[model samples]
Target: MAFSGITTKFTRSLVIKMAAILKDRCLRRIFKKIDFVRKPLRLNFVTDNGQHSIDKLLVANRGEIACRVMETAKKLGIRTVAVFSDVDEQSKHVKMADEAYHIGPALARESYLKMDKIIDVAKRSQAQAIHPGYGFLSEKPEFAELCFKENVIFVGPPSSAIRDMGIKSTSKKIMSDAGVPIIKGYHGNDQSNERLKAEAEKIGYPIMLKAVRGGGGKGMRIVWKAEDFDDALESARRESLKSFNDDIMLVEKFVESPRHVEVQVFGDTFGNTVYLFERDCSVQRRHQKIIEEAPAPGISSEVRRKLGEAAVKAAKAVGYTGAGTVEFIMDKTHDFYFMEMNTRLQVEHPVTEMITGVDLVEWQLRIAAGERLPLLQSEIILNGYSFEARIYAEDPDNDFLPGAGPLVSLTTPLPSRLVRIETGVVQGDDVSVHYDPMIAKLVVWSKDRSSALRLLTHSLRQYNIVGLSTNLDFLINLSNHQEFRNGNVNTDFIQDYYNDLFPEKKSLSPDLLARASVYLILLEKRKQRKSFDDIISPWNLSSCFRVNSDLSRKISLNDGYSDVEILLSFENDDSFKIQIGDNVMKGFGNLEINGSQKLLKVTIDGVVSKLNVVEHNNTIYCFSMEGNYKVHRLIPSFIKSKCEAMNLGDAIAPMTGTIVKVNINNGQTVKEGDIVMIMEAMKMEHVICAPKDGLVENVYYAVGDTVERNSVLISYLKEDEKN
Candidate 1:
């Protein structure tokens, strides 16, 4: 019995030891798996190689850029602080920030460009970083250096990169050294008029004059002939002085067939870099881009590779970090020459993001926080095509002159995962003349270019804005242009296809006019019904109401160019017999109210048409697939006659601006096509010329005085009244 008990004890002990060994092996494997999956958590902004954390960020800019940065910062669990000017107190960015500080006045120089003030705000807000958006102090190396000295992070490239790239003369030298193709231009330190003239002569006529430190199409002009050199130089200088505080100019040979293409490049402090692909931004007016697309349709893979390599080389030459765009001007043969490098994020960066499916802003933050690049050159693949159409408060028919006013009624297409509307203003927001006139950026993406274009056109048609003129119609027309759709794009796309793009005068269709009339009548009835006690009120009738009898009333629809007279016989509130100048039509319409917006569903002779309608200040603005139409309820006969006859042939200011120079005085004789004065607005010069041969009756403004738009800057004396 004793021997058996001892054997049993030994067996139990062996089993226990085996179980312990198994548990030890399982723990070792689990720990090894965990070590394989886990990564070192570190932020770029942390000192000593990401040993600290960034708690708050301060945005030292305004408008869309400010809002854009905050969106990414919020997503990454970083609080954002905003600084606004007096004019931007109620801006979207200010409202979105966790905390906001008033920086300065409305003018950019006094507010957004005040680097010292911005730094002070950052310090006071206890922010660890300052994001200078594209404009203002974004490219200022001094600002970046100051941020570094203050021990605050600057969310852009190194100060050295900005300094070297911000100056065209310096960048050209660097790019040339880096084997990047450069246009033959005189980028020297000589600033004398004689020297500049000599350089221009050497470069030959048709030279492109650009400010050494200019951006956004400002301080740039094309001189077609030697005779225009002096004027062009002076104009470029004045604009550069106002915009960049630099008047030094560079002259280059103007490439007749130039297309603007830029490659988005990103880098990390660890010496890693990659290109996010290219964007074709050729469609422009006034040297500013209007439409941009990614992957640059129709380019050979060889050219794409060369462009990307050159851009990466350019970035490396300057030790560039963060997001920077290398702009190139490619000729007909796809031979590209380096134009300039933007040291900060570009305004059209979204197109590249859409095509790559990468969040550039997030990448910027991560890079700034000391993180390595989240992508590799081989991994950054261009997927489908994408396009970005910039919607601005400018008139395309009138030279795209920027305008500013209230966005009285604003509505956009239904938001979706594919379609994005990026804007800083909302309905009832005022487009201040103190800044850029861009309203929003309409972005669409699809599996191919054709599908993306179709979506863009459809979305444009659905966008409705009233109380101010917009480029919506022009964008729609451009999207439909054969050349644009075929990818035959260039910088002069607008100028080259002006006739086809603007088309001849268009007359509203009878169906559209009838729908407008019904829409207006229904809106009025709704207003009356709301004012009364009953929701179902029979008293709400058409303009010419009669009991049990059809009444006919005349209504006029004018779209700024022509007028259409419509006679509508109302059988009831929902049915009408309409006659538009000789064409008769019958329609039954009903209004469906959708939260202060009215959608009119009308069937004209069994054909259904749906339009989005907004009524404001006695004007009914109707938007449909056909297009948008505005009809004033009351257009007196006298006003129409007045528009036809120019009583005094006065030359009025086309837009609100400062009178830079008055070329004529009272009693001066002037002939048609003669320059009478020059006005500067939105950093652009507009020449006012005489309309007819007559004596100047009055000069209402002086050289340094501001004037309202359409103000009579000069009036011609009547024939019989001239002294």
Candidate 2:
């Protein structure tokens, strides 16, 4: 069957059942060969050889992953060396490392991808080992080989293992030869476009043009029909060249709605291998995993066994040592096929750790030091459910475009059953364009998948990040999705439900806005008290600061929102409730007053929310959620008049960026929806269009010119004028 057809039939729920059947068959065979001396196998890789420890290690990567590796190393009393580019001088990884080295320029090719410079820094810092941290040199066989030749331990799989699995085409062949089920595709090396097209025809439509050396969905395209093949192929080839510097492309059957499941396997020098169970990474966007979970939901015991055995076979085929992941595509009919093997630690390793209670990094360090696997496959158990949501600095509403700017405010809820934020970047740290936009990994664990999903959704709602766009809303919606809750997932889940998941614009309710305004006013009042000692008066009993303002105000609220305005009458200093229309909202807060200023500290829905109010010109401007809004303030008459008088042809540039393309010319007649210009900002192209049918009066900027925010790019005359 075609890959897409096979994948479309596969769903996460059905794959779980298939996994159980496979597991049973494999285990039964193992029991047949079991003897007193060969009853399965228990491998111990850690030795009591006086506890060998490396003094310091260099993290050859940057960003969150580097910080994550350093955290574990630090816990084990190991120092860390951080390598940075000119742009990363103030990066979180650089700040976290005990020692740092400047590599080269901001571009990755000149720094992070430069293995020689990284090694030189390690040597200069006297580091004993180097941890690649899952990008750049993580899966590069040459890097491990160089580290081995230099006598520095590579804190991952051996060079031989990387060589076998790092190359996708070879990895697929190796897995297939070892009797592992693999996706039927043209793995041949014929890079000619004509040959690829012929191969795609053989494979059937809905084919995927993928780069031989691609990750993160950069050099991949899905062609649904023959007519789209040529365009997709060209695009895939161009992206592959830009991303991997390899124009070599391959034609594969595109899997439709197939679940992405991978088994975590560990091996040691003693030829012992064990599988640490599996993780479901089916929830994705643009071929990048957004949410990951371990002990995959809906998979029966039978299918789990099959996946584990196949994963083990795939690992053995490559002589894999240390930590690695064997990925597979499973359909709803329980059919499974190997995708590829990742010869390094995965970014979602934290999910596995949460479920298994094992530190994969520490084990990787031990294995690289010539140790053997410590636990047998039978000893490993799948425990509770865990979910990991990657918090990225991107605008989910804007096609998930990467967001870059300083993190002005970051607040995470307390770690509990509902929330746990594992982040490296702190407030004030700049999210640069030099690296991936991911800022943190938020993980939630529970006794079951449903509970875990609920906990994740609640936690995400409480997370507050300002100054940069994030995918928080998208994650929240995904967690609460009907398909997700039922374990119905696949790679195309995002695209399938993009419209329902995100709306063009979201507005706050008027009552919620009013409440937010009140909170902001109170918060500002508190701030004024702190800065000035004479803002509050102490002896006025009626106006004296009280702890329970909601009770005193007698405010009634209906369904958390109110339409009727009710007079707030304070009954006491600490307690008050406001009755808005027929609903009342009762709340209390700790009152602190300094001179004329007042402070109210309140807790709402088990989370602390503070409100500060300052009165100026009998109006309030509330500052909360990192955005400021004026409350009860009259609009400026002059500004309102000017807005009312402005014409429809007015144009303004959205942001500071380069004018990449000027599509319009002076005196050119354009329709209402005609594209006038295009600008490139923050690596995304934004098009400026005509507001109405009119003649182009002027073209303010030419291609290759830098423009500031709100700068006029083009202007149009009246619609009646035909050029």
Candidate 3:
């Protein structure tokens, strides 16, 4: 009895010492609160067969999804391993993992998609399970089967379930047999051209032709007339073959102005399944979702029940045993039809988690370890509303084409209880051309839809990113759209409200220009301060203070709308008197930068703003709530002539992509609307057409050649010189 007492006292002292090791006070408190639920997995995970241990997990993916998965795994005290390609060696996900391994080259086909390499890494790392976060190998049945064979738990549904839901045609048939409403489509085995054409004729014009194995808006086309059917079919087939290596397709009647909604479902090995309400993902550009929200608005409770029940029924039919998303298209009469099943965690899962107060990844791990769901249908609570807006490195004015470059400056709102940020890149990280160019996701929540939307709008305006083009301004405009605020969501929302969303361009105001000029001078002062030799130089001071006289200077500012000339008279070190055209203003502005210079806190004319600044290629890019502006300190006397001479009447590449086809050749004469070439990027095709009637001098690139943005692909002889 004395020996037992001595041993117990030693164990208690060790526990106390371990608790004191957590240096962060807040983290220590959080750990204490979670200690109750962090009991040994072996206790509750044991079954009649044996004990399944998942102390370590390997994430067979990269980017934001991989980071998101690791967060929950770490919270549960599970070790994480990360694999990265050559380009992703310095990625955020790689840095977050407890251990990292080099996979392969920069291309995904050689790295993330290599099943053998990933399995080899998992074995070497001694991982007990593998988490295929979202994209790459998440939905591949073969990957899951291999993991099962290797005795490593796959933190997802069964392989058979993945196969059943992967193919659009097969999933549609399964849903129909399960008594779920399906859109009228031709999901038959007939692949011959004649049969597809006949099906289209039966369905009538305005048909939707989609590849049986496609996602992310690829391998899909909409036909409005009979004459356009053949071309659309060939284009869709070509893209399908490139994306999935399968050209099979299905035709359906195009449902106009329908809302895109999906239900989140989870199932366990115990055969219990539950649905977590619905998400409206109707705001899109080029058939890709840009904004999503939970607890779909303007829908009756009866309709909500139907959606949730249908989703659960679909999951049970496949014996799904993890998190999955079931998508549906709702028509004007509130009738919803099964579209397809994602068969994995979705990119917009955070919005659902915020409303339901559930951690989906945690549930995924528990279910994979053969544990019953922690909550039942009756226990799941839905409170408040949430919104998630996807931020991408793309130019909205250029048909929303994707962009690739370095993120020289990135400053986002601080994450808190009501706000969350999921990102994959940091300052100075490159947005590679080999993968999707999504920068991050901004999420917000509130007590109601209006309040949540208002918070989202405010957060977006405060998100400052520079050194590459982004769709930040466009997303802000979309959230503030009147129709969107009223919850009038539909597939055609963007097209129907195009005018209001993208109004006519407006020139920068005098006050805005003056503020930019003040910012430029402050940036120069900062540079001088950093140089030891110029710290006390008189030339570094403001123009007025240096000479004690009326100082005149002219600067130029461009915000992608119009260029303006600002006449500045420096009043003092912290203020300026400026004029743009006929308007004049006097304002005080001061810039306080953090250690890294990525975040610039400023106040101009009593309005405080936080801007992200990047000085590259002799130009200063200032990103703020007003908008993004590029300022040039010195102006050339022949600036107008220089700008006009730069326009060479050439068909330039809109973005970095691979050339797939060239329709014109040297010495070929083309009309104004003639197709010149085709380029593919981000899994979509873009057509380049002739700008005017002229003779093609030469084509710079051939098929399968990579090209950069704004590079001249086809130069044309001037119209006057053509004769």
Candidate 4:
């Protein structure tokens, strides 16, 4: 078809425009979704009248999970109601709720776990649904049953499913019957101590004692020796009863060096189930996960398929109809045995969401609203690698001892499209004794495992917290470990690489001395400037400033584990020199303000170092690329003498907790290493031992009495000052 030049030009232009339209980025993405993703997961499933069945949701719990749920609910245009204990009224979750109700006191038993109180609040607030965000009543069959009776939607599995999966013994039996591999153990109703001990011996030593209804590492103990079986059983039972309100116990052979791999599965009321993927939660302390990632590393696609199928099978066996995790213990060869199935959302659910690009909470809400599965198993694609490092207010050097304190300073890695900071508290908030010590869950993702891991460690370094010991440094070290980078991980990772992870502090570096000196000098000038009209005023100056000579002063600071001494000299405002041992350096520093974040940048002999600093209670925190260092100013002897004298030989409460057992009475003699008392704090027990062999002069707190941290629990008679 011959045509004029103008017609040819128009024809060519039209073809070009068509080609461009097909290649346009936005259109390309839409076509990709049509071909690959099929359809994006969304919440537009309204009823026939364009109304959601659940208009308001009452979160029957507290902490990060509660806040997380509220966020999703709000995104779906659902009003959220939060229930809090007295101590949690000021918590982040409470503030995020549309309406909040104070349930009871500080103890969880009297508050969050009071199903009746929560149900009452739900009905009073006219909440159409109750989303028990993990822990508390999330797995309680009675709570689900109560929600059903009250005609409110329970955003979890059916009560029967909860009853079946909530108990490990029942869940194990069901898994075994369903042809899922089960581990060797006794899951029968033999609660007698004698029977358990006999079972442990028969199953052989090195058995695991787990609460029948336990989750989150609560009520779990490892008995390595036959002699320790009874004690382990008793302790496990006590903790189980306190945590789950059920003292039933289950025994299983402790799988040595196995990886704790779990698959995230979602089910709907219409009998549809899909597995998102699997997460490796093998690196842990106290048998609780510290870091988790998905889809599990070093896993073959065939094995992955098998894992997903088995997890789906387990969910089907229980007729689960919500978000649930099927946990498995995988050996070195990838052979796996079914562990207990978490009846609700797992603590590490964020990782699954990251990899699958699906909001499990949103799925729960939709399913509870009578919606079917959003996508088929084949369409649910695993796109990337993801990791979740749980930041906790705990002392890693002290066996990861749980801590309760004010978060005086909290500077976290900024959350992005691929990064999430799952938390329920903020700076200046207290980590209460009546709850979990986890500060937040730092979730990050990338295209591959290595990049995701690098991102994870980088984020952890920026996760700075002050006012209490934390495991941030430990996590950073663990993430960068050689074996971990190579995908060599297991439940014994921490134990296997303990030395590399917890290395002793090296001699205080010159950089540290310079940083500390610079912080003190600038801080002093700032304080003096605030106190008076001019910072340079002669009367306002509190430094070693002199007109004729370079004035020097001896300064001391405690670096958490030891005392660090520095001889610092200065002549003018920016003139300063710091000396530690034979090492010496000169530096001038200034502070940079970015919103609420303060960066202390110091140039020592021309090399500039930027640091995030937090000053609180005489302690100066310096955060750098290397690590976070805390230097506490020592109290001078003059003022120290004015305060009440502390007995060096007294056994003090290491944390705020109730005394669970007192082994020594007044006037009783104790050996140097004897256990003086045991206190329960933050769901873990801390033992106070005799400082030295001496007579117990006083027992200040009895069993069941709560004591403040650092308070003397027992006074030991010193040899020099014996009564």
- lDDT (tens digit, per residue) of candidate 1 on 107-129: 78898899889989988999988
Ranking by lDDT: 4, 1, 3, 2
Which sections of candidate 3 miss by over 4 Å?
Answer: 1-51, 525-550, 558-563, 570-576, 596-614, 623-646, 717-723
lDDT of every predicted structure (CA atoms): 0.85, 0.72, 0.85, 0.85
Task: Give each model a TM-score.
Answer: 0.90, 0.76, 0.89, 0.90
lDDT of 2 by residue, 247-336 (tens): 877778987889999999998877788888899999887678899998887889889999999998988877778889998998887678
Could you tell me which 10 consecutive residues in candidate 2 have the lowest summed lDDT? 35-44
- Residue 340's lDDT within candidate 2 is 79
Provide C-alpha RMSD values for all models, in order: 7.7, 11.6, 7.5, 6.7
Q: Which tens-of-lDDT digit does each residue in 1-723 have in candidate 4?
A: 898999999999999998896665455354434332223233333333454467789999898999999998887788999998889989999999999999999999899889899999998999978999888888899989988777777889999999998889988989999999999999888689999889988998789999989988888998899999887787888888877779999899998899999999999989999999899999999989999999899999999999999999999998989999999999999999998998999999999888776778888888888878767787677888999999998889889988899998898889997789999999989999889998999999999999999999888888778888889999999999999999999999999999999998775567876788777767666766778886567746544454444477677887656667888786566767788878888778897656557788888878998899887877788898787777778887733652444546678777789898888889999998898888899887667889788788889998899999788888877677773
lDDT of prediction 3? 0.85
What is candidate 3's CA lDDT for residue 423? 91
Q: Give the TM-score (vs. native) of candidate 4.
A: 0.90
TM-score of the candidate numbered 3?
0.89
**Candidate 4: lDDT over CA atoms?**
0.85
